[model samples]
Structures are given as structure tokens and as C-alpha cells.
Target: MIRRFITRQLRQPLPPARPESDPYARALPKGDLSGGRPAVVRVDGATKQALETGRTRLLVAAVSFTLAFTLIGWRLVDLGLMADQHEPSLARSLSSDALETGRADIVDRNGIVLATTMPTASLYANTQHIRNPQRAAERLAEALPDLSPAHLRAKLASGRSFVWLQRNLTPRQQDRVNRLGIPGLYFQREQRRFYPHGALLPHVVGFTDVDNQGLAGIEQSFDDVLRASAKPLQLSIDLRVQHVLAQELAGAMTEFRAIGAAGVVMDARSGEVLAMVSLPTYDPEKPAAAPADARFNRASLGIYEMGSVFKLFTTAMALDEGIVDLNDGYDVRQPIRVARFTIRDYHPKNRWLSIPEILMYSSNIGTVHMAMDAGTPRQKEFLGRLGLLQPAGVELSEVGQPLVPSPWREINTMTISYGHGLAVSPLQLTSAVAAMINGGTEARATLLKQDPAGAGKGRRVVAAATSEKMRRLMRLVVVKGTGRKANTAGYVVGGKTGTADKPSGGGYARNSRIASFVGAFPMDDPRYVVFAMVDEPKPTKETFGYATGGWVAAPIAGRLIERIGPLLGVAPRGDDNELIEQMLVDIETNAEGRQLASN
Candidate 1:
């Protein structure tokens, strides 16, 4: 009976269970609307899995965006505040080859490009792949006229894996070579150092090797710095002033028939080198072909006994150390004799000359007496303090070491005081002179630009009072002394003339002399130091066969100061009454030792 009942229930189709009770049935579409109950939509297992994955992806994207923004913000902060000690990022980015590997540029203080690198293509050949070597050589020679056809042929036929046809090729040249349709002739990317000013700043900017390596001048002194840095090296040189100085120096060289010449213009207050010139200079583009003499930097590398320019230092030492006063006088009646040497003045005044007279006339005997009073120890210390006893501390590798007497004997001191027995470069002399007159502040020569505020913090080398006296004395020299030729209108030019016989055969040559003149303008408020020097200048008809400093170099200084004054914005002062009257001193005395003005 139970078997029969189970069979009947299964056959009735289990009376169709309700859709609300079946979870799987809720996801199916309703077939008819007759049921009155609303259909419920349920999420399937696959849809739930897809939604979970989407949420995970969105969270990851949000985290990544947050990290990216944080990194960008951190980098900005680092550049603005943390990188203050680093080089200027903007300057580094502006270099011609800053996008690739290249040396930094060298610019003048005024942002004029002195030395730079340009994009170039170097021609190289894979000899094995080159067909018809002679044809390739002939075609290449046509493109590069400077390259010899025979030389290029030999290089292509060398059977080597690679060979260089040319180091630097211009865009036109590269395009011409490409038109030849020669296989194995290819261009390798390269950079070539270029000096836009050419010979204008060869000595200071210097040249590079075939591989663009620094070999001399500021280049050698700061090679690693240039290679690693992207910013330009801004030198203290002003291109405008440099051009004027070079032009004048070249004219003097030709006029005087000088073997060589040098000139320097420096700021007395800041020790900044406004202009430096050495002739004959070579074109930096072809330094290898230039003569050896043209490569020499006479301003900083050639040491010489600077003649009466040394007297400036001697007089300053005496005044600063209290060994002598302006009123003191020395008997210059005869030439001094000491150990087979006779110290004679170029323009001797045969009488008891006052200190001002001795300096103005450049008396050797009076200078010797002043040195003896200061003693040898004091003389050595004074010169050492002025940075004259050692190599000049400039920004060049070719600085000259001063020739000093090892014994430091009394004769040495006396001779050195009168501008002999000691040899120093023109750069050293200019630096010392700047210090002596710039309110006695130590003026350090440098090639790099200096900050205006930081320039005045150097050590005090001499008393300000002593410096005032020196300014007056130098002005007297230009107005009524050997430096008369250096006096320019409205400039109040003040300076000293120096003429030293060149050393030959263990003695000074009577004929060959090094003539130099160093001057400062607007003596009421000294601004610039202008120096000119001529080596082995021959006498000219204009000077009546005189190659002395007064005839040769003094006039150059005067003309240079006049041209540069307006450019430097130094206003001309017409009235000199107050300055002249204040710096005046009694030139002679009466029997009662009272001061008296000389006519």
C-alpha cells in the first residue's frame, strides 16, 4: 500500500514549490504577470566576484596617484630650498649641449659667450665595408677641402676595423658627404669646443684638446669643475673693456716695435679683473699652429724686475711703519756704491731731496736710504705681506714665482727697494698697488666674479691714513713727475713710470728695456688700476729714440683711461680745488725748520 501511495505523489509533480522559497528561482525572469508578487533581483556568484575585483583596482589606482603627487611635491621642495648650495639649475639647463654630454660654457661677467661647445658630427669609416676606397677619399676631400685626398685614401686603405676621416664637420659638410652615397661612411655624434670671440680671450678662456679636455689657463685650473658642471663659468672679465685694452696694446706693439706686450685693468676696491690682455695672442680655434711666443701670458707668467714701480711699495712701507715722513729728506748728491754695484737714478736731483721729491723724481739713492732705515727684515716682511714674495695667487696655472734673494742681505734690501734684486709678475705689482691705494685694504686678484658686499671684507694691509698719503703722492707723480705723460683731461690720472733694463749675460743690458706704466683714475676717489707693459720696445722717431716708460707706456695708460672712464660711468669732475688743496704739502723748509710752499 505505501509503495502505491509514493508513486502517486511523485506523479503529481510535487505540486510545484513556491518561487519565494527557492533562492535560485529568484534570479530567473517571471514568465507571466498573473502572479501579483513583485520579482526580486539577486546578484549571481560571478557578478559578486567581478565587483570585488573592481573595488580592489580602484583602491590601488588611488594609492598610486597619491604617491606620485607626494613625490612631485617633495622634488619641488628639494629644488627650492635644499639645493641652495648647488649650481644654478637654470644656467645648467641652458648650455648648448646640456641635453647630452658636453663641457660647461665660459662666459664673461656680462654674459657674453667666451667659450662654448657646439653639436657636430665626426666622420668615421669601417674600412672593411668601404667599397672603392679611392672614390670615397676623392669624394670626401671634395666635401672637406681641408682634408687631403691622399691622406684620406691611405686611411681608408689601412685595412683597419675603423678609421676617423674628420673630427668635426658642419651641417652643410655632413649633408654634402651624405649626398655622395658612400657606404661605410657614417657620422658619429660629437661635440666640438668653440670660442666665439676667437683670439679675443684666448689666454683667459684657453683652448681644449681634440677630446675636449682642458690643457691650460682657467681651463686647466678648473677642468673637473667644467666637465661635471652644466652652468657656465662666469669670469670677472668684461668683454667691452677687454676689447679696448687689446686694441690699444696691439697699436702700441706695432708703434713701438715691441716683441711682446701686456695690459691689465682691475677694480681697486673689489680686486676684480676688468680686463687682461697679452700679445701677440693666438687664435684659440687653431692653438696648435700658433707660435710658442704667442702662447705666453706675460701679464701673470713673466717675472721681471719691475723698476720704479717697486718704489711705490717702498714709499708706502716707510710711511706706514713710521720709518719716514713726507717732510724727511735724503742727500742724492752722488750714485750709491755697494759691492761692485752702482745705484744711479734715471733723473738725478743733485741736492737734499724731500720724500715727495725723491718719489716724484724716482731717486735711487733716497730710496736706498729709506730701505736701510726699515732694515732687511722689515723689507722682506712687507713684501711677503703684499703677496709679492711668492707666486701670485691668481686663477691661472701659469703664475710666476717671484725671484727673491735667499740670503736677504743688506745689499739685497737696498737694491730691491730701488726696484732691483727682486722679480715679480705684472699681475703681482698691480695687485699690490691696488692694495696700497684702496684705503689700505687687501685686494686679492681673482678671475671669478665677486659679490659686492663680500668684496670689502679683506684684511687691512695698511693704515687708512697711510693710504691717504699714498694717494696724494701718486697724484703728485702724475701732475709734476715722470708720469706726466699719463695725465689725462678730467681723469685726474695718477701713476708711476717704470723702465728696467733687461737682464742679459749676468748683467743688465743697456739697450733692451722693459717699459711699463701703472695708473689709477679719478685720484680723488680711486676706482680702477690700469697697467701697460712693453717688452724690448725699440726707440721710435716720435719719441726721439727713447724707449723709456715715460715715452712708451705712460701715454697708453692715459688713452686707455680716457676711453674706459665714460663706459664705466665714472663722471668727470671739472673742479679739483678742494682735492688739490687738501693733498698739498710744503715742498721746502727754512732755517727754523718751518714748512714753506715751493713755487
Candidate 2:
């Protein structure tokens, strides 16, 4: 009908038979053509008007077709050639979604992938266009067993323009949904934050939510950095060292039947945390399913009174301030009475003790006297400079605050001198200890990789001579003191043992203790500061019914140092007596010290 209408519209109505009476018609002589010339006839006004209308309609139709084709071609070019290829969803979801960057990958200093983004298909729907809602829901449920058909059907039936059917669908599941050919069911290409190392790097790399927002650890701390930058966040962590630390810490935790365990391996020179382990850790992929206790980061977030380790600070301060020398003696013949409390050493010498002997025996009373000589004001100032009087500035959101006594009285100073009144995170202690042994340079622990040239010299926290004396004392401890079990051959390990009773209820738990050891290798020139702590460790047969730091935690450090030293290319210098003699103090040596030196 339309074709006939167009044909009629284009055809001028036949000029009324003008043959009989019109002069023009008579002139034309009934369409007769002579002399090879056709008869000419004048067109009527209505016919001319109809012809003009037909021509105008044809031109309009042609223009419309050209414009339509031009638009289609431009769209094709825009999508195929001019579109942002980097933005995978730009062209498809332009109107409904805003531009977003893919979350940057997190890698270790060695370029090992700790956390990354993986492409996945997420199912969504335009409920308004969904037909046969119940049927579609049933088919989707069959494809994705985890999703309920009833819930899906209710969502599809709801008179809404958009709704999420499911997120992070596996390829097989996505394929199954596609085969259903359900209207309004679509797949949105999305990136899911994936932890390739799973629980191993969970606390550091952290986990993300469905929308790829960082929630904990370094991820949470550097969330804005991760989102804005496309480059991978390189951490100071060494995957190899992390594995070693975690393995040894887990073994220690199990052997001692402890509640938990934490460990750290930091470069004393650069303050780079090569390895940090907190056991009972959760998998980043299934963070929600993990218990709250499992998510607790003990290494940096759990603050405790770190027993005799504070002696390292106390001794360093006394020496740095010229208040005490290696030969300086402190009378610890009896427990020092301070108010209602008394400072007593677990292994009391019951005699005047030199600074070296004080540290070698880990005498609590001796440390208090040393702090007294340094004076309370000087002790506080010294600890503050060592980064021990505050929270550690580590690059993590779960950092804990150090608990220092308010109105710090003489008793508080005495107790803090032995690590009772002052509570600090393992990180703080480790960093401070690192500085004490690393030529007195202030060590600031960090998670980000450091530039070799730009490690930026740390401010001198203690005198180089004091640091050297501390190193000698630490070496004496490992050689002939409580840390004898930590004497790994050829490593020249130097360290301190801490066995602090866990504060419980009101006072402190008798049996429960945080046994810890902080050590550095190559004592002549310290490198890494390795620390290990076991929470609430119980006595084991291997430990000879002792759960002190020397028994429970020192061996862990020794083993870790022994293993990681070779891996880190630190060749063992077998019995470098010359180096040992250079830093040796003029103290009376027993038969044990002679035997250890000979060996």
C-alpha cells in the first residue's frame, strides 16, 4: 500500500484529455510526432506542485539515510579505534559507571607478587527488562549453586532498573549463565583483588572488599596511594626471609604450645623490615571467616612489658651519657627497694656487678642502678631519642602505642629500666636495639623499599663508643651469658633475652609470660636485627622445664640467623678472635668464656 501511495504521489495526474476542445491539445494533434520532434505540452499548476512535493520527499529520504549511516560509522570508529583501550569497561558502561583506575599491584622488593588484581565477570541485571522472572531465576540458580533462586526471583520481579545478581563469577559459571540466554542478565567485567601468596603475606599486603577497597595492613594505610597510582607498591619485605621467619616462628609456637608467636628481621643499617611474621594469621582471601584473634598482628600491634630487653636501652644510655663504663660497677647485692616494689633479677649475682656483667647476667637490679646513675631525666630523654617512649612509626595501620607510666616517679624509672612499667611493641624494641648496635645511628623501621643512595643517614641516637660497648656486651651475653643457646657457630651472634610476665587481671600472671630474644649478627659490624617472641609459652622438655626467653626464644633467633645469613650472602667468619678481642672489655672471664672462645 505504501509503495502504491508513493507511486501515485510521484505520478502527476494525467492531464485531462485536452484533445477535443483545447487549443494546445489541438496543436499537439493527439500526441503525433513529426520531423523527429516530440509534441510539447505545458504542465498544469497542480501537477507541477505534486511533482515538486515528490522531489522534496525523495531528497529528504536520501539525506536521512546518509545521516543515519554516518552516525553508525562514527560510532564504530569511536569504539574500535578512538576509545580508551586501557579502560576495559569505558564504552560498555559509560552512562552507568564512572571512570576508575585498577587497583595497583603490591609486590615485594624483589618483584614478587604479594597482592594483585584479577579480571572476573560479575553478573548484574536490569530488573525492568527481565522477562519470566521465575524462570530466569531458576536457570541462574542452576548455574550458580551458591545463589538462591528465590532471592534471585524476588530481585528480578522487583520493579527496579538495576540490581546485582552475583559478583565475581567463575568463567564456567559465567558461561553457564550466558547459555541461559536470559534477558537483562549481563556480565560486568571487573577486577578482583587477589592475594597470590594467600595467608603468607596477608597482614602486610592486606585484603580488599568487593569494591576493591583496602581494609587492613599496608593496604589500608596506603589505600589512597594504591588507588591513585598505577605502579606497583614495592615493599621492603623479602619473601624468602618471610618464609624462614614464619616457619621458625610457627615451630616455636607449636613446640612451646604458646597462644601465638611473632617475629621480625630488620636490616640494622637501613631499618628495612626484611621479614615480619605474626602467627595465627588469617588468609586475606577469606578474612571474614577468620577469627578476630587470628587477625591480631602481634609483631607490631601487641604491646607488652618487654622484660630485660630494655636493659639494652638502659645500658646504652648510661654509657652514652658517660654515667657508666664497662668497668663501672653497680651494687646489686640486695634487691633495690623502691616504695612498695623491689627490683630483683631472675638470676641475681648478689654482688657488685660491672656493666658487662650486668648485661651478661641480665640482672634487673643492676639495670635499675645503671638507670639511677644515668638519672631519671636522662633515662627518659635517652629512651625518647631511641624511639621507645612512643609508638613505632612503622608503615602499618595496626601499629600499637607504647604504654609509659604517667607522673613517671623514681619507682617507675626503676621498673622501666628493667622493662616493667614501660610497654613497647616488638617493632619499637627491635628498631631501638638496631640503632644501639648499628653504630648508634637511629633506626626507623619501614615497610616500603628504600633507595640505596637515599637511605639517608640516621641521626646519631647514641655515641659510637657506647654502641660499640653495647655490641661487646651483647656478644658476651651470647658467648658466656644467658643467651648461650643462641651461640650459632661462625655467626658471632650478639643478643639479649627477655622473659616478661604477661600482665593479667590486675597485676601479672605468674605462669604466663612473653618470652622473647633480640639479636644481631656479625657483632663487630652489626647487620640484621632478628627478634622472636612467643606469647604465653609453656615449659617444654626440650627447654628443660624453663620457659624463659633464653630457653624459648633465643634458639629461634639462632636458627633463623644461621639459615638467613648464608641466604643473605653473609659468609661465616669462623672464630674471628682478633675482631672479638678488639671489642672485648677488661672483665674477669670464667672457664666457660675461655672454652667458648677456644671453640
Candidate 3:
């Protein structure tokens, strides 16, 4: 019936064919109407215009869609084929710009890497996007075994938008997490501070916190400079010298059964610290795991009474002030009783001693007499000038302040003259000794590498003649006195021995002692100052059951100089006793005349 209806409608569709003269009929194509086919039907102008507009819009839409799809396809091909070449360049660009956002590196004077920063991946999550929190946590825990499953589940179920899963993940760990295909898990790029030498330079280089903030040593001292600059911070430390000093110090500490040790190697002429070590040390990369005592910097931060080393200052002060001469003699046979204190010699000579003999024997009675003659005010002034009354100004935040007597009485003066009643860090003693031997010029101690051409003319703490006399006396000590163990052959080693009892319970401890030696080689032209100290060293069979500086610390200094002299380019010369004798002719002649007169 439907087919018959369509046939009837088609038979009636031949309403009227327009003539060729009509504009609308001209628009239609010419065709024959026959065999039940519908004849042409004419429509109004508005309907024809609407149909033309619709066709134009459809054509424009097709072209736009085609162009968009073509561009997208080209992009996919470029990414897939050129990924190997493009990825490395992209990584280089990111690494090159890392210093702007990350911390700068730290290196030794030779440009050896000490501390640096590297890129790492940190895992985080958008907890809201995680479905089935328990299952997601279990999967994540498997990928990162260090993370707790319960912790992860709590974080994922907290209904929070974001949470940190782990920080500083390794490449393998990151790959494992990615393979888990967790929906909410993500990775953030971050930078971490690394120490290549690890425990070797914990005290000097220091360590940083998780946020890359410096907390100790040079790291704490120069934190702002490290964060703001792109260039590596170079120190005056020579890695070779550092190793030798630390090795020698550690050996001595172990052999003597010391509780701790500290050592420093410094260029006497320039005042640049070549090496500074304090033990026991810690690993900079894992400072939190180390004990507090391991992190203490004894060289610069720990203060103690440095015993007979203080005599160097007292003798230098007397000579510089014209209060005493090399031939000056003092009777050191009797002990000096000042108020409630008694000053006596460790090794006594029951006769008069010349100035040189007093220092050689380390006579505390003679030193007290010298201080009494110089007066308390002059001794105070002299020490203050030597940079001992104040804290050391080296490039370290862990520096110690000297403990000086408040009233500055005569008893204080006498005890301080023999290295008691005043406590100073080893750095202060080393720096002051450097000045005394370096032609009397006070070179401020520093840790940064310095240009020799730009070095300042240092302040004169003593006259050049006084410094020469002090050197001669130090040499005399090494040749015939307490520092004999420190006299290495051909180097003309000159030094002072110091053994101070550690203060305890309002007095000196009988068993605990600080044994130390400070020495300079080729006394004629001193270049470097080497200082070694052992804290609370116990008596050993090899040391004759005594833990004095001459027995324990002097041998360390002697061995260290022999090893480092070649490395530092200090030439060995034949024994210069004849020359030293000629320089000391006046003192020898005076002593002979006194002996002849007494005989």
C-alpha cells in the first residue's frame, strides 16, 4: 500500500514546469520527465538561499578538521623519531640552569670536588585521585620497601589533595614506582647536596640539612654565598697535606689511646691554613647518624691550657721589650710561691740557667720570674697583640673564645706566663707562633685561598731581631732540649713542647692531659707551621708510661715534617750547626766567661 501511495504522489508531482525565460527555471538542469519519474518542481527564493548557505558551512568545517588532524600527526612522528637527540639536549639545558635554583659546589684549592649538588626524584601523591586507598598503599609499599604500608594507607585515605610519599628516590626505585601504574602517584625533580670525600672533611667542609641549609663549619659560615652564587667556593686546604696531617694525627691518637685529636698545617708566610683536622669525625652526608662528640671541631672550637707553648710568647715578649737578652741568666733552682700557687719546673736544673737554657729545659720558675719583671700589664698587652686574648678570626663559625682572668692580677700573670690560668684554642696558639717565627709580622689566619701578590703587609707584633732570637731559641730547644724528638735530620726543625693537665673539678685533672707539639722546618727560613695535639692521651709502654708532648706529640710532628717537606718543596740542606753556632756566638761566649769566672 505504501509503494502504491508513493507511485500516486509521483504521478501527481507534475504540477507545472517553468518556462526557460524564468530566472528560477534557468537555475535547474534540463531533463526529460517520463516512466513515472517526478517532474521538476519550483520553490521560493528564500528556501533555495537557505539550502546554499548550509552547504558552504559544511564544506568549511570539513577543511578545518582535516588541517587540525594533519598537524597533530606530524607532531607525533617528530616526537617519536627524534626523542633520543632531543632528550639529552633538554637535560643539558636543565642541568646548566640548575645552579640558579640550587646550591653552588664547594671545592679544595686544587679544584677537587668536596661538596656538590645532583638531581633526584621525590615521590608525591594527589590522594584525592587514588581509588581503593588500601590497595594503592600496598602496591606503593612493594615498589618502595623503605616506606611503611600503614603510613601510605593513612596518607592516601586522609582525603587531602596532596601528600609526600618519599624524598630523594634512586633511579631503580623510581622505575619500580612507575611500573606499578598507580593513578595518583607522581614524581618531583629535586636537588641534593653530596660530599665526595665523605668523612675526610666533615669538620672543615661541614654538612647541610634536608632542605640544603648549612648547619656547621664552612657550610654554615658561607651559606648565603653558596646559595646566591654559581661559582664553586674554593678553600685554602691542600688535599694532599690534609691527608698527611690527618693520617699522622690519627695514628698518634690511636697509638696513645687518646680520647680525641686535633691538627693543623699552615703556611707561616701567608697565614693560609693548608689543613685542619679534628677527630673523631663524622660523614657529612649522614651527620644525623653521628654522635655529637664526633661532630665537634676541636682544632678551632675547643679551648685548653696549652702548657709550655705559652712560654714562646713570654720569652718573645721579654726580648721584644728589651727586658731580657739571649745571654740573660736566671736562678731556676727554687720554686716560685705566688699567693696560694707554686710554679715549678717539670724537669728541674738546680742551678742558674741562661735565657736559652731556661726555654730548653721549659723552666716554669724562670718563666714566672720573666713575667714578674715584665709586669702584668705588659704581659696582657703583649698577648692581646698576638691575637690570643680574643677569639680566632678564621673562616669558621665554630671558633672558641680564650678564657682570660678578669682581675688580671700578678698571680694570673705568673700562671699565664707558664700556660695556665688562661685557656686558648689550638688555632690561636698556632697562628701566634706563626707570627713569632714569620719575621714578627702578625698574619691573620684565614681559610680562603689568597693571592700572594695581594697579601697585606701584616702588623708587626715584635721586632725582626726579636723574631730571629726566638727562632734561635726554638732551634736550641730542638737541638739540645725537650724538642729533641721533633728534630728531623737535615730539616733544622725548631719547635716547642706542650703538656697541659685538663682542668676538672675546680682544679687540674691528674690523669687527663693534652700533649701537643708545634714546629716549623728549616728554621733559618721558616715556611710552614705544623701543630698536632692529642686530648686526654694515656700512658703507653712505648712512651715510657708517660704521655708528655716530647714523648707522644713531638714524634708525630717530626714524622709529619719529613713526609710533607718534599711535597711542600722545602729543600733539605746539610746540617747548619756551624752557622747556628756563629749566630749564637754571643750567648756561648757569655756562658764561657761566666764559667771561667766561677771556676
Candidate 4:
């Protein structure tokens, strides 16, 4: 009977099955309305086997995917949760326990915030958890206008679990984003360095990077010290003094129409830096926005031919070695000729000038003659001792390397006498000045506040008598010579004026010049030495169209002393006019005054 039934079933033509392309693959098709009954067909054995094989393959693939996801999750949890191995990330990587993680605040001597690091939250998202990427991104985009909707959509739609949306967002933005109630968004804490004073002490305190890494200035030099200690990094800079210096320097820059300006105020006794400024400085809070030139630290880093300032060193060397006496005179009536260059005075005396008068008049010819008398070997030896022809020992990131002649030929000796050929940084000049004033001690500069016991306890660089004579000569320059404009009332200011034409290709530019004034206050009891300089100041109506140091840089230093004296607690003393009789002589003052009366 079974054989007979099978034969009958085979003999009957089996209905064909519907294709799977139909809306319901396994469903039966409706019958035609022409009175045909609804019909269905069963699958043959071969077709049934194919369907079973496809189902088994799909199940295997799904199982493999699940196992892969499980293994990936297990590994991630293992790596990220091993906090004991990574001592820093026990709770989070932002913890202060990590070495070099959190730096101490940088404070001025008075404990004002020049630099500090603050913890901020950064927003990220897990795209795998994002159900509706478009809606979530739309909401996030509204909260962060900097983000484009389409780009945020891609970020949300990405398969990544940890994608950054924004870092260091503002508090208001964070609050607003939290209110939006996005599901997959998360926050991670990070350190953001801030400079509240902005550009006030740009070169002194310096600026950090976006990641709180030290990039320049003091920040870079003392980074290791800062990271290791929680105590405030106390600097020699007083913010008040820094502000006064910056305000005065910026104003002078505007008044003189200078291309650049730099100034420094140092303690003549201890070599403490009170205020130093280099402009046009940029805001440390936004260092990337600043131009390349604005980032240049000119005060300590720019080496220039600082015209007559070197004469101080030359005269001191001559006197300390007994090569010349205060009464020894040099015939500066004629221009000095060597090889192709001539050393000549701008305003010549055309006669013999005493040692003191030579510096007082800033006679280039007289200085050259004095150096020749001192000889090349002695000149080199003296300058080497004075620290004039080398890198400054100041604690700064951008100290300029002095451009001294390697061979130091006879021409070099002559040119250096007139403050040319050899170039030196302003910081080198400041240290040299302090050496000349502090009873001839060579104190190295430091940024850290000076402790009673420190390494800068200096060695003697010159004789005390030589320092006294140099002080008188510096005073003479301000009282009766080219630096007359630098004499402040009751300040007992002493200094020399330097007007140097900037060197071009192999020669000095004809019209472009640098105006500089280096001074010390209370010359009789020297306390502080200040150096002010202007690069390429243009002729102005107020200056009587003069671009010399007397017209530009001298008054700037005088004004700075006036502004900073009270701030630094330097009480202004009465003018030491009693010493002027011996300090200034043959100053066209006595001779010209008599001549005017006789006429």
C-alpha cells in the first residue's frame, strides 16, 4: 500500500513552490478568482537540505561574533582596570599622585599668580551606545557651535566607544550640554594651564602648552622643580615692578615709534632681577596666536653691538690693571684709521681728554687709543675676566650667545674698544654693570628669589678704587655728556648713552640705528642698574627729529627709574652734587660756560 501511495504521489505533478523574492517566503499564494481552490506545495528533500545548511552557517557566524565581542571586552577590562600596576591611574590619570602630572603654581615674589594649572572636563562619546546618531549629534552641535552637525553625526555614528567631542570646554558649555541629556556622552578630567596675568610677565614667567607642558622661558627651565614640589615657585620678579616696567616700556615704544624695545632692572648689590621686559610681547594665555617676532625675548636673548656701553668695561680694565690712570690723557683729536675701518667720535673734542672725560664724552677715538695702549693680549684677558665676550650666566631659556671674534685680531681689539665688532646680550651688559658697581664683585644672575645662602656669592672682578672711579665717570655721562637726559631729579642716576647704527650685510645700515641707555641709581651708594633700549626708533617731532639715545632711550630709563623706585622701596636720595666736582671735569660745562660769559 505504501509503494502504491508513493507511485501515485510521484505520478501526480507536484505544485511548484513560490520564490523567496515574494513578501512572505514561506507563505502560500492566493488562488485565482475563477473558482480554483487555494493551493500549497511542500519542499523537496534537496531544497530542504540547502535551507538547513544555510541556517546552520548563520548560527555559527552569530556565535563567533558573540565570542569575539566577549573576548574583546574581557581584554579591555583587564588592561584598563589594572590600576595597581599603573600607580598614577589608580582612580584616574588626572590624579595629583602621578609624577610630572600636576605642577605647582608659579608665583611672583609676593605670591601672585603668574601661572597655574586647573582641572577641566573634556567631553567624549561612545558611538556603540548611540541609538539615534542624528538626533544626538544635532543636540550636541547646538550646545557646541564650533562643531558642525554633519561632522558630529559622523562622530556619533562611528563604531568607536571613546571619541573626543571637545576638550576643556567652558563651564557654561558643560552645564548646557549636561542639560541636553545626551545618552552616550561622557566626561574626562584634564589639566589646563592658565596665565591669569596674560602678557604682563610673558618672558619672565613664560607660557605652557595646551597639555600643560612647559614650552618656553622660566616654565621650561624649572619644569622639573615645579612638577616635583607643591610649594609655589617663587621668582625674583615682582608683578608690580613688572607691570610698571611693561607699562613704561610699551608707552615709550609708542612714543618713539620703535620697532622693538627691551629693558631690565637689576639689584646692583645682589643681582636680583626686579623687572625685565621685552616688547612687543604676546599674551602667554594665548601664545599660539602671537606672531614669531612677538615671542622673541629681546632683553636677554638679542645680541647687538651696544655702542658705548662697552667703554665702561674698557675703562675699568685699563684702570684695574694700572695700564692707565684717572689723570692719564688720550689725544682724540684725529679719527683712528686701521686697515679699512676708522674709529671716530660723533661729537669730537679735537684734543686730549682725560680718562674720565673720555667716557663722559663717549669718545670712540679716545677709547680705541686707550685700548691700543692696554694692548690686545691684555684687552682679551681683561674682557674674558669681565664676562663680556661669552654666554650670559643668567637663568633664562633664551640667553644669547655673544658674537665674539674667535681669533680676536687687533682689529677686533680696536672695534671692541668702541663697542663694535663683538656683540653681547643686554643681560651680559647688566651683569658687567653690577660687577663694576658692587665693589667689583661678579655676581651671576638668577631667577629664583635669592636666599641668604646661594651659589651666586660672587668673586671680585675689579679693584674697589676702579669701581669708584667708574661710578664717577658713569655719573659724569648723565650729568654733562650724551646721557644728560637720563639724569632723574634726586635719583643720582649714572649711565652712558649708546647710539649704534645696526649692522646690515657686512656694514652698518646708513639710517637705521639702535638707541640705548644703561644706568645705575644712587651712584654714591650704588643699588640698582637699569638698561633701556629701542631698536630702529624713527625721528619724531617731539624728539626734535633726533633718533639718538639721548632723545629716545635715555629718557625711557629715567622714566622707568621714576616709576619703579617707589615700587621697589628704593627711597630717592638727595643728588650727590659734592662728588660732581671731581666726577665731571673739562666737561664743556666749565670751558663752554666760561666761553659764553667771556663772549
What overall lDDT, based on C-alpha atoms, would model 3 receive against the true structure?
Answer: 0.87
lDDT per residue (tens digit) for residues 1-599 in model 2: 44565566547543445544554442445545454434445455655676688888999999999999999999999889976774766544742332263577889989998988777999999988887899988888988999998999999999788888888887898899899898898888987888878788677777888888889998899889888776799999999999999999999888989999999999999999999888899889889999998899888998989998888888888888888777677777798776677667787767667778888889988888888877889988999999988888988988999888889888888889888988998999899999899888888999999987655289989888888888888988888888888888998999999999988897899998999999998898798899999999999787789999999999999999989999887889876555346335455553245447658
Instruction: Name the TM-score of candidate 4.
Output: 0.79
**In model 4, which runs have C-alpha deviations exceeding 4 angstroms?**
1-100, 131-142, 145-157, 452-456, 585-599
The TM-score between candidate 2 and the true structure equals: 0.79
RMSD of 4: 17.4
Q: What is the lDDT for 216 in model 1?
A: 84
Q: What TM-score, computed on C-alpha atoms, does each candidate reach?
A: 0.82, 0.79, 0.82, 0.79
* Leading candidate by lDDT: 3
Candidate 3 deviant stretches above 4 angstroms: 1-96, 129-153, 179-182, 582-599
lDDT by residue for model 4 (1-599), tens:
43454456557755664665643334445664424644445556655566677778889999999999999998888789964677755655444453456688888878888888877888999999889999999889999998999999998998898999988887898998999987889998777878888887788888787677788888898888878887788888878878887887788888877889888888776778878889999988788889989999888889999988888888988899898987777777889888877777888978777788888888998888889889999998888887877888777779999898878788988888878888888878887898887788886766778875643358888888999988888888898888988889888899988888899998899788888999998888887889988988888988888998888889888888888778877788777576568545545455565457758
Better of 1 and 4 by TM-score: 1
Clashes of each: 0, 0, 0, 0
Can you write out model 3's per-residue Cα lDDT over 43-114, one digit (the tens) per residue?
556556656777778889999999999999989998999789798899778766785667889988899988
Q: Candidate 4: count the clashes.
A: 0
In model 3, where is the ten-residue run with the lowest total lDDT? Answer: 26-35
